[model samples]
Structures are given as structure tokens and as C-alpha cells.
Target chain A: MTTTNLPAAATREALGPTLVRLQQNGANIVVVDADLGKSTSARTFRDAFPERFFTFGVAEQNMISAAGGLATLGHTVIASTFAVFAEHAFDQLRMSVAQPKLNVKVVASHGGVSTGEDGASAQSVEDYALFSSLVNFTVCVPADVVEAEAMVAAAVATPGPWYIRTGRPKIPVIYTDGPRFQVGKADMLREGTDVTIVACGLLVERSLRAAEALEASGISARVLNMGTIRPLDVAALEAAAKDTGAIVVAEEHLTHSGLGAMCAQAIAATTQPVPMEFVGVQSRYGESATWDEVLEIMGLTADGVEAAARKVVARKR
Target chain B: MVYGAQSGHIGGSMSSTEILAVLYGRIMRHDPKRPGWVERDRFIMSKGHCTPVQYATLAESGYFPVDELSTFRKKGTRLQGHSVLGKPEGVENSAGALGMGLSFGLGIRLGMRLSNIDAHVYVLMGDGEQDEGQVWEAAMAASHHRVDRLVAIIDRNGIQNDDFTAATMRTEPLDEKYRAFGWEVRAGIDGHNLEAVEEALAWARDVRGKPALVIFDTVKGKGVSFMENNPNFHGAAPSAEQFARAMEELA
Candidate 1:
């Protein structure tokens, strides 16, 4: 997966059209939005299938509950809002959808500090943790437009509750043409022996850059695009830990309970436990800033991942 | 069931007993043997804590074997403290956290329209459950979308888990609020009167252009003389002596 000549696009750009295409194919899909359909790309679905699309006008709790209600009637409901806005609907998704294993897919955009200029309130750094905490939920953070499209189709094809966080900013394409993507699986983009760099969502592109930089500095760091956060690919993680002996986990979410915390727990639970460093936001709120500035502030970049990879490799005995 | 369970919400259960009876016994088109019948009308118990009356109605309606009623609230039993979907077969939606039924019913009504299935969705709520902001949110959306055949019934027993709605959170004047939200208001009906419940439900089914709200005025505990309008009976189950007295009074 080379960086140059690859098309870059925001992850949400794929959501609505993908659903529209699926609906054309006779898929039983319902799209629910909390008055942010245009911003979240759900407007495309709403326009394509006006009868199946519903808007709750800035009320996320009702939207989620209604989505769950629709799911009970044999429709695959996809509810959309900003990631931070989803905080109000946590218990609704948890009880009505997740607990009962309903066929409701909650897809949110504007994730992380990379959601630039929207400020701290809009940036959802804790969304991954909040969604993954729910039982019977397939939590996902797509790396790029292609992965996001596949996740939407996969979520519709599968029957159960799903939580997918798509990025707001455009990033470099990481996959080849029509690459095979699966939910609850990890994609090993690069192979290395010194250390493993695991990342998700928009962080995958930066991790690839960090791996490239580390290769130039004679430090071979493997890059893994871990899209599915829950039902995590523990086997791949354990194999990576066994092979590399050190790892660096990075994401656009907080290091406290998102990818960083999951990876740490995976490493500790694995037979081949290894030293690891995390490259993500700590326990702090983000402010109004550009993507690069927010990344710099939160230490979530190629340089930050590279530095963490180096530190982890050094710590390995 | 409440006397046997020793932990069921007897007050609210007794309050909504006749309403549930009139629904299952006369109004709803549900099949006990076929809980997933496509054309059947759906009932959502949004105020989930009052499961004793709900379970009794379902069991009495033949949704499941009546003998299983004794296992209420016990370990590994299908009868949970709160209503859960698929627990006993006829249960339509899972509920416990208040103020979710209307939105859920709206979703069902919308789905029915999409599928071209002419089925009604009835959501039974509580007076105290109105305090949850999601109820108003759902109310606004249901009427805005003109979701017909979506009916909401409030068990206006006045008491909550421990106190009254007027004292805790003050969700007073529910009829005006629902009317403003664009629902047909049918207020001040006796919930314990089986005929009134039947008439209100019949009126709600014909409500076109928008959703309908039926407010039932009732006592917290309707059967037992000692527990009637008594707030202490909200969550607390009756002791053996009190249960014996209640049985004699109902008999």
C-alpha cells in the first residue's frame, strides 16, 4: 500500500451512497439521522430513499430508540449523528439495541480531534471507549473511504448491533483495488521485525508514514490497520507481539480506554506479552484547532507514533 | 405473582391491571402461540418496572403456560423483574429505563407504514416516566411525521417509584403538552373501568392525521384496600399477612 498516487477522501463520503446502493439491491435498510444528515453524509441516503429515511431534528435519544424500534420490525436500521452527539443516546443503544442484539447499526462521523475547527465539544475522543463498552456491539473505526463503504455493507449484511465511527477529514488510501475487508479482523499492511505499529481510522495513514520513516532510520516497524476495535483480532495481536516483541498502539481516541487500553489488555492477556507504547490523546479535552495542530497537541502523528515505536523498541530486553 | 416474587412493583402493577386486561383480553390482535405474527398489533410497556400485571396478562392470555408465572423474578426464569422482549413470548419490547416507549412505538409505526402492514403500535407509559426528556422528543417527532396508529397511554396513578409525579420532577399538565406536540388528547378516563379503557382504545385506533394520547386516571393500587393510593406499595411487596388480606379483599 504505497502512499503516493493514492486517492484521498473523507470516510463519511462513502456512508450515504453505499447505503443507497444497498437499498437499490433490495436490502432492508433504514437510515435515521438527528438533523445532521448533510454533515454526516446520511442526506444522500435520505434523498435516495425518502420513504425509508427518518430525521428526529437534533434529538439523538429518540432517534436511537426509534431506530431500535424499527430494527424489531425486521429492518436493518442505520442511525447517524456526530460522534460527540451520540453521547446522549448511549443508554438507548445499550438497552434497546445492544442488549437485545437488535439489527441496528449506529454510524457516526466527525470523530476525534481530526474533526478540526469544530472545537472540543464536537470532537469525540471517548466515542470508541463508550461504544466498545456496550455488550454485543461490533465496534468499528474505518481507516479510509473504501473501508468505510465495506463496513456499511458488512453491517447491513450482518444481523446485530453495530457502532461504526467514520472520520471527518480526508486521508490517503491504504488499500488496493477492492481489497477483501472483514469485520472483527486486522489488516497487516507492512511487515517488520523491530516493532509493530497498530492503528485505526485516520491514524492508519499516519502509522504507515511512521513505519516508512522508521524503515529509513533502520527500525523496521510493522503497520497494522486495526479497524474493528471490539471483537478485536487478538490472534493477530498476539502473533505481532510474539514476532516483534514490542508494539506501538495509536488512534485518534483517548489512550485511557480506546485502542491503547484494548491493546494493552490484549498484550497482557496474550501468552507472548511484550512491551508497548501508546500514541493517542491522554485524559484531556481538545480545543479549536486545525488537524495538524490538534495532532501535535495530542501527540497523535507520524512523528509521535515513530517516537513511541522507538521508545518501545528500546524498552524491549 | 407479586406476592410470590417478593420484589415486584405491586402498586404500579395493580394500577395498570385492568388496562392491560382490556388490551390483551379485548383490543390487541396478538396470538399467544405466534408472538411474531407480522400483522399483529404491537404493545410496548415503556414503564418496565411494573411487570407483574404485564406477565399475568400475557400468561392469562395464553402467550405462555400459566404455570410458569410462579417463576417470576427467580434465577434463570423467563419472567424478569422488568419486561423483556422474547422473555415469555408475547412481550413486544424490552423496557426498564423510563421514557423510551413512545419513540419505540413511533419506530414501529413507521416501519409498519414502510412495509405496508396496517398494524397499530400502543405504548403504555407512567406519570413519573413523563419526566424523561426523550418522551417529549418522541412526541414531537411522532406528530411531526404524522405517524397514525401510534397510541400512547399514561398510567396516571400519580405515584412514582417512591413519590408522586407532582412532587418529583413535575410533569404536570400532560394533556396540554401532548396536544401542543400535535397528538389527539383523550384525558381523564378511569383506568380501572374496563369499558372506559376499551372505548378509549377504540377511539385511539381511529385517530387519523396524528398520534393519540389516552390519559387514565387511577389509583396506585386498585385491588387491595390497604394499598390503594398508598405510595409505600410502589416497589415494596406485601408481607404474608398483608398478602392474605389482599387475597381476601380481591376474592
Candidate 2:
């Protein structure tokens, strides 16, 4: 599939419109923000649906538990905050939302090092792992504005707990309008046979660039956007392992318990196990820098993904 | 039920028996046959460890068979050690961890008010459980939003797991603390007195435009003489001799 050349837009931009659209369509969507509505762009939803919006005033725990309560009353609840602050309310989310499988949508923004200049304290590289470990959660890291918008709509219509991680910086548009976004499905951005480069969130754009670079060097690299981290698309990973024989899993999260670990587990359980390489932060904290500078320093660039893809393919027996 | 379980929070359970009796028996508007009735007032036991009182109230209110009280914490029973939502009909929220009930109750009240559902949310929390920071967070939010039709009752038994709450975490001046957080505080009421508990409930319902809290000054084990204010029975089950005496005292 051809990539959309539209200008880069922050996932939060799409999130605002998506929430408004769902509310306009008569969805009983209530938004709760923990004083980060401006950053998470939940302010837009609050503006459109002021009556349905609530400001929890910097209390992430209260916001999450309140979301659970709203959900119990059959309201489609969207709780928004910075990803790092979400850790404060993990127990509340685990008990009130995940264990009970409440219909609460936690749309945490500023995921990973892309939250430039905030330093390690604000960056959330382990949120995906933390949320995915919950028993009944649909964890999604949207690849671009389009996918983020679609996933928010899908999450609202779908029941149970959901955690959709969006980034702070604006990333290139990877898909056209109305992408086919499912809860536990992976989107194949490109199909190939030599090697498969799997990625999610902002890294999907880098993976696409890496795939193009690999093709010029006579390597047929496939790109798969593993959006839903929990309830992973194991079938797609198995198919990729069977076909490509080598895989490179990339994400803007920690190497441990993130998408790489998830893919490794899936491949290990399969009959045909492929050589795999991980492209992510390797057990270190991030510092203040521009998004691109941090991505380069953390080895999360397209060159990094391309190098991992070649290394994995060379290790294929 | 506590005797049958052989292991339960009998102390705190007994302390809140009158409060539960007042709410489930006469105060709250609920239909036993229709536990999921939309118009029913939502009851969340935030201090979930003391679930024997809630289970007994639920059973007596006909949400489940009265005989099911024998299955408390037993295998193949809907009544677990802590109460869970949807396990037995009418249990609004699942809770074991402390300090979350008020927040959950605030959310339900906000949703009901926004949707024009016309319902009240009652959250039962323990005085010892006030140590959790999340409870204060919900308290601030509830008062900031001026969440009406939300009633928070604290089982202020003055004791926690190891020792007294004042020694454990100093949660005294609770009424002032709640008032400082903007809640309408009702303090120093006899929790064992059914009439006093009912009067407090009636007064809390009339105080509008903000959340109301009724702090019941209660004994840890109110009904039975041997267990009253005794920290040993906080989590300990009664033995045969103790159970016989406790049954006689309660009777």
C-alpha cells in the first residue's frame, strides 16, 4: 500500500476531532482529564461537549477511578492524561477498570522519548508494557493521525478496558482517511519475503523509511504495524515468521516487556521460530532533547531499524 | 457467616452492621427482585475487607437467598472474601484495595447527574483506610465539582490492622479535614444506634449542592461485648466458645 504524503500532524489533533465526531454521532462519551487536557488535546473535546466533560485537576488516580464509575453507569468514558502520570493510578486502573473489565478508555499522550524536553521523568517508555500486562485490556499504539482517530472511534464502540497511547510530536501521515483499524489486528504496510520489520506508534514511519532503504539495497523488507500490543496479532506474527524467516520488532518503548518481548514470546511459541532483533531503548532513561535528536541518540531512527533488519536476516539459517 | 467462614474481618464487619442495616433495610431506594434496576441507588463498599456486613445486608434485602450467607468466602460462592461487582446482584463496585470507593462513587454520581438519572451513590469507607492518598484526591474532586446526591460514610472504628488509627496514621480531625476539602461533614454520631444512623442518613440527603459525609463514631466490634474495641478480632474469626457468646450477645 502507498503511504500518504500528507503533512505531519500530532495524534492529539486527530484525537480531538474523533472525540467530537463520536459525541456528535450521539455516542454517550464523557471525557475526564487530570489537568493535562491542553497537552493531551482533550481540551478540544471539553470545548465541544462542556457538559459531558470533567476536569479532575491533576489527580490521575481520581480521574481513572472516576472513569471506572462513569463506565459502570453505561457512559462511554474517556480518561486522558500524560503517559508518565498514568503510572500514579495503575492500581486504580488495574482494580477498578481492568479487573472488572469496565468500558473505560484511557487515552494517554506524550508516550516515549518523543515527549521532547520533558526529560526521563515525563517520558513513559514502559506504559505499553504496564498496561498490556493487565488481564482484560485492549492496548493500542496508533501509528499515525488516521490510525489514532480510527482507534479512538473503535475503542468507544467496543466494550471493556482500553489504553490507547499517543505521542507528543507530530509524525508523518502513514495512512489515508478511514483506515481499517481493529482492536487486535495488525496492519501490513508492505509485503515482502526477505525480512519483516514490525513497528508501532511513531516508529511506523521510520519502519516504512527503513523498508524503502532496504529495497534499494536489494532486500525485500516487509513492514507490519502492530497497533494492538495486548491480545497481540499472533496470527500475523506467525505468518510473517513462516514467510520471512527473520523479523525485527521496533517500538518507542523499552526493550523489555514491550512489543519486542511480546513478538519474541509469540515467535517462540510458534512451530517456525525466526531470528529476531529489537529496535528500542535498551534499559536506560532518556534526557531532554529534540524529538529527532532523542530518537537518534536512542537508536530509534530508520537507520537503526534497517541495521537490525539486515542483522536478523543475516542470522536466519 | 463470620463464624462459618472461620476467617474474616469480623471486628469491622460488626462495627458497620447498624449502618448497613439502616441503608439496605430502610434508607436506600432499591428493589430486591430487580437488582439491576436503573433507578436503584448505588452502594459501594470501599472498605471491602469487611464484606460480611454487606453480604448479610444483601442477603437480608433479598438480592440473594438468605441461605447463601452460609457460603461466605466458600468455594463456588458468589460472596468472595471481598465484594465484587456483578458477582451477586446489587453489588455496585468490586473493591478490596482501600481508598477507591469514594472516587468510584463520585464518578457514578457525576454520570447520573449528567444523564439526569436521578440516583444517589453511597460509598462506605473505613477510618483506617483514609491513609490512602487516593481517598483525599476523590474528596477534593467531589467537593470541587459540588457533587450532590453523593453520600460518603466512614466507619470510624478508631482501629486498623496492627493498632489504633491514631497510632497507625493519625486520621483524627477527620471532620475538619473533610470540611477543609469542602465536604459537608456530620461528625460524632452513634453508629450502633439504628435511629441515629437513620437520622444522619436523612440529614445527609437534604444537604444539597455538595457531597455529604457521615462519620460514625463506632466501636470496632459494637454488638458483642468480648469483641468490642478489641484489635485482636480485627481479622480473627471467633472460636466455638467465643462464637456461642457472640451469638448470645448479638441475639
Candidate 3:
């Protein structure tokens, strides 16, 4: 898909309108916010559906448990809060929502170091890892607003527990139109055979840019937007390893437990194992800075991905 | 069942037996034959460690065969160590971790209100479970929403796992605390007395525009002579000799 003229917007900005649409379409959807309706863009749903929206004041645990209760009664509940704050309700989410396979969509905003100026405490680089470890959880990190809206619809249509991590800042538009997003399916943005640049969330756009740069340098790079991390698309990873013989995984989360780890495991089990390079936060906390600055410090840029792609391609032989 | 399983919260279960009996027998509009009836009142046992009483009540109420009580805590059985929803027809929520039932009950009550279903949600909690911060969070929300269909009953057996609640962590002035949190508080009622339990629930049902709580004051192991007020029985199952003695005492 061509990226030119694609509309750029924050993932959080698409949450409210998308939820309203879901409710309008006869979905028994209820929106729950933990005093972050404005920040998480849940206020859009709150303003539209006053009766269906519930504001649990800074109480993420109670909000999550209540969401579970509401889900048990056959309500499709969307519980929103900052990604960092969602950690407070981990136990509740695990037992009440995940274990019971309740239909609760925990949409956490301000994911990763992109939540600039809030410092280390506000950044949630470990959310994907935390949620993916739970039983019966579908973990997603949409690359752009188009994917975000489609993912919200998909999450509602799909039953059971879901965890979606969205960024605070506006991300580059990767899809001109709403992409067909299926749980555990990867979107191949650009196809190549030299090396596959696998990425998710904010880093997907960076990987696309790196793929373009690699193309100019006479190196073909395949870009796979791995939106869903938990129910990971292992087939795509295996196909990439078989077709390209090398892989480079990138994410805004820590490299150890995020997409990189999942991709490594997938590749190791393939018929022909491939060499891989990881592009993510190297087991460290983010500081208070602009999103661009944090990206540069964490080596989460197109240049870093391009460099990793080159290194992995060299190790292929 | 506890003696048969050789593992259970016997003390807390004994203390809460009458409350469960009253709920499943005299109160709560529920049909044993139609356990999945849409308008049935929901019952959540927040202090889920005490499953023996709930299992007994469910059997006595005919929600399931009384013979199934023998499978409590056994492998591949619905009656696990803690309460699990859908495992038993009447078990509204799964609980083992303390201090989550009120929040879940509040959600059920709110859901019933939205669905236009006139049903009450009853949450049975342990006095020691109040120490968890999540309990107060749910309390504040229950009151803030004015969930009138919600009723929280605290089994104040005065003992925790290791010692008495007074010595472990002072949860005194609980009635004042609930009142401050905007709930209609009914405290100091004898949990063993069926008439008192019935009256408190009736009063709570009549309350409008606010949640209600009934604090039951009772001995830990009320029916058992040697187990009464004994912390050893808080989480231990009866031995062969002790089991015989208990059956005789209750008989």
C-alpha cells in the first residue's frame, strides 16, 4: 500500500469515534475510564453515550473488575486508562477477565516512551509483555489510526479478553484506507526477499522508512506489520525466514519480552533457522524528553532499523 | 465435604453457613431448576476460600444434586478450592483473591439496571478482606453510583488467618467507615440467628438510592464446640477424630 497522502492522527484520537460507531451498530458496548477519559480520548464516547460511559476515578483495579462483571452480563466493555496505570489492575485483569475469558477490551493509551515529558513512571514499555503472558488474551499494538479503528471493531466482534496498546503522539499513517486486520495475522507492507523488517506499534512506520532506504542501497527488505503480539503470526515469521533467510524485529517496547522475543522463538522453530537482529529499548527506562529525542536515544529510528537489517543480512551467509 | 476433602477453610465456612442458608433459602429470588434465569438475583462470595458453606447451601437449595457435595476440591470437579462462576449454576463470580466481590457485584447491579432487569446483587465478604485497598475503591464506587440493588454482607468472625482482626489490623469503626463512604450500614447483628439475618436483608432491600451493608457478629466456628473461636480451624480441615466429634456436636 502507498503511504503518500495518508492521513496522520493519534491512535487515541480514533478511539472515541470508533467506539461510538460500535455502539451505534447495535453492539452492547459500555465504556469505562479511570479518570483518564480526556487523555485516553474516551471522552468522545462519554460525550456521545452518557449513559453507557462510566468514570471510575483513578481506580483502575475497580474499573477492571467492574468491567469483568459487566462483561459477565453480556456487555462488550471497553476499559481505558494510561498504559502505566493499567499495571495496577494486572491481577484483576488476569483473574476476572482473562481466566474467565470475559469480553473486556482493555485499551491502554500512552504506550511506550512516546508518552513524552511524563518520564519513566508514565511510560509503559512492559505492558505488551505483561498482558501477553496472561491466558486467553489477545494483545494488539496498531501501527496507525486506520489500524486502530479497525482493531477496535475487530476486538468487539471477537469474544474474550483483549489488550490494545496505543500511543499518545500522532503516528505516521501507514494505511491509506482501513486495513483488513485479523487477530494473529501480519500485514506485509512491503515485500522483499533479502531481509524482513518485522515491527509493531510506532516502530512499524520506522521500519517502512528503513525498508525504503534499504531499497535505495540495492538491498531488498520485507516489512511485516505484526500488530498482534500474543497470538503471534508464527506462520508469517516462518515464511519470512524461509523466503528471506534473515530477519530484523523492532518495537517500542523492551526487546527482551516484546515482539523480538516472540519472533526469535518463532524463527528458532522453523525448518531453516535464520539469523536476527533486534531494534528496541535495550532493557532500560525512558526519560522526560520529546518523542523524537526518546526515539533517537533508544535507537528506535529508521537509521537504527536500516543498520540492523544490514547486519542481519550479512550474518545470513 | 471439608472432612471428606481434608482441606478447607472450616472456621470461616462454619461462621458463614447460616448466612448462606438464609440467602439461598429464605431470600434471593432464584429457581434451582432454572439457574440461568435472566432475572435471577446474583450472589458473589468474595471470601471464596470458604467454599464449604456455599457448596452445602447450593446442595440444600437443590441447585445441584446433594451427592455432588462429596466432590468438593477434588480434581476435575466444579467445586474447586475457591468459587468459580459457571462451575456451579448459582456461583455468580469466581473469587479467591480477597477484596474484589464488591466491585464485581456493583458491576452486576449496574448491568441489571441497564438491562431493565429488577434483580439484586449480594456480595458476601470477610472482615479481614477489608485490608485490601481495592475493597475501599469498590465501596466508594458503589456509593458514588448509588447502586441501591447492591447489598454487601461482611462476615465479621473476628479472626483472620493467623490471629484476630483486632490484633492483626484494626478494622474497627467499620459501620462508621461504610456510612462515611455513603452506604447504609447495619452492624452488630448475630450472623447465626436466621431471623436477624432475614430482617437485615429485608431492611437493606427496602433502602433506595444507596447500597446497604450488614455486618454479622459471630464466632468463627459457631456450630463446632472445640472449633469455636479457634484460629487452627481457620484454614485446616478436620481430622478423622475431630470430624467425628464435629458431626456429633452438630447432630
Q: Tell me the tens digit of each residue's lDDT in model 2 across A1-317.
A: 55446668888776777899989998999999988888888999989989999999989998998899999889999999888998789999988999889999999899999987878898898998899888899999999889999899989999989999999898888786558778789999899999998899998989999999899999998999999998899999999999999999999999987999999999999999989999999999999999889999999999999999989988985
**Once model 1 is optimally superposed onto the true structure by TM-score, how far is the C-alpha of residue A246 displaced, in angstroms?**
0.6
What docking tier does model 1 reach? high
Residue B101 of model 3 has an lDDT of: 88
Ranking by lDDT: 2, 3, 1
lDDT of 3 by residue, B14-68 (tens): 8998898888888899998998898998899999898898988888998899999
- In angstroms and one decimal each, the interface RMSD of every candidate reads 0.7, 0.7, 0.8
Off by over 4 Å in 3: A1-6
TM-score of each: 0.98, 0.98, 0.98
- Judged by TM-score relative to the true structure, which candidate is superior, 1 or 2? 1
lDDT for model 2, please: 0.90
Report how far off residue A307 is in candidate 1 (Å): 0.4
Q: Which residue pairs collide in model 3, if any?
A: none
TM-score of chain B of each: 0.98, 0.98, 0.98
**lDDT of model 2 at residue B91?**
84
TM-score of chain A in every predicted structure: 0.98, 0.98, 0.98
